[model samples]
Target: MNIIPILASAGITGFESPAAEYSQLGCNLDELLIEHPSATFIGKACGDSMQGVGIFDGDLLIVDRHVTPTHQDVIVANFNGEFVCKLLDIKRRLLLSANEKIQPVVINDFDTFSIEGVVIRSIRCHRPSPLLSNK
Candidate 1:
């Protein structure tokens, strides 16, 4: 969903070669990208506040609740009853942003905040999917 579209150019296949030994290879993406499947969930980013970190609006966020968040880790959290994505500054107890224009949010004692998960992966779509509405 950051899917870098490859510009496929036209190519020519001169002649059919003899049938050599062939094998089918299996590729499971989940095994490569996910560590904790049951504890992981995917969410879509919805704002321009984290573009500097390569997480843009409409990017698919793979958040893992089982993973412990570290300092400066990008995370999804329930901030005041709503979900938000931000950088976790544990020492300062604040939510920071990659974009300079977006101000950091301090976590006060009165605020209702809970860390939902640590953002492990994010996907961006370079082109619209055929399954989705065409623009």
Candidate 2:
């Protein structure tokens, strides 16, 4: 898909006239990957299953769908019919945990589970504290 351009409009003194200006903020996936080979754009992360791994809510995960999932690799998978992210333990047929609080989930039925992609990177934003006020 091509990059969707944003146009800026400026109002005229007498009447509001439409004006167009190209935007530089937005980018196309093809152009971005070409410029940065290590970069991969996937869907947003949900749930706290991977919080210990520094992947929190609303984080954008860069998953290389082409990459083969290995032991301990964080992967996006389709369990039954729902999508989930977890550590892959191919040998033991289990999903390991980076957090002690969360236990490893075993794959008793392989037919019900399917790996979608391997997580390559995670992106998060730092938000300013709302409670703290300036004097």
User: What local distance difference test score does each model get?
Assistant: 0.86, 0.74
**Per-residue lDDT for 1-135 in model 2, tens only?**
444454444644564333333335456665564333564446677778888888987777877777878888999888878888899999999887667788888888655998888887786756633432233
Candidate 1 lDDT by residue in tens digits, 50-78: 99899998888999999999999999999
The C-alpha TM-scores of every prediction are: 0.77, 0.61
| Model 1 accuracy (lDDT, Cα) | 0.86
Q: Which candidate number maximizes TM-score? A: 1
Clash totals in order: 6, 0
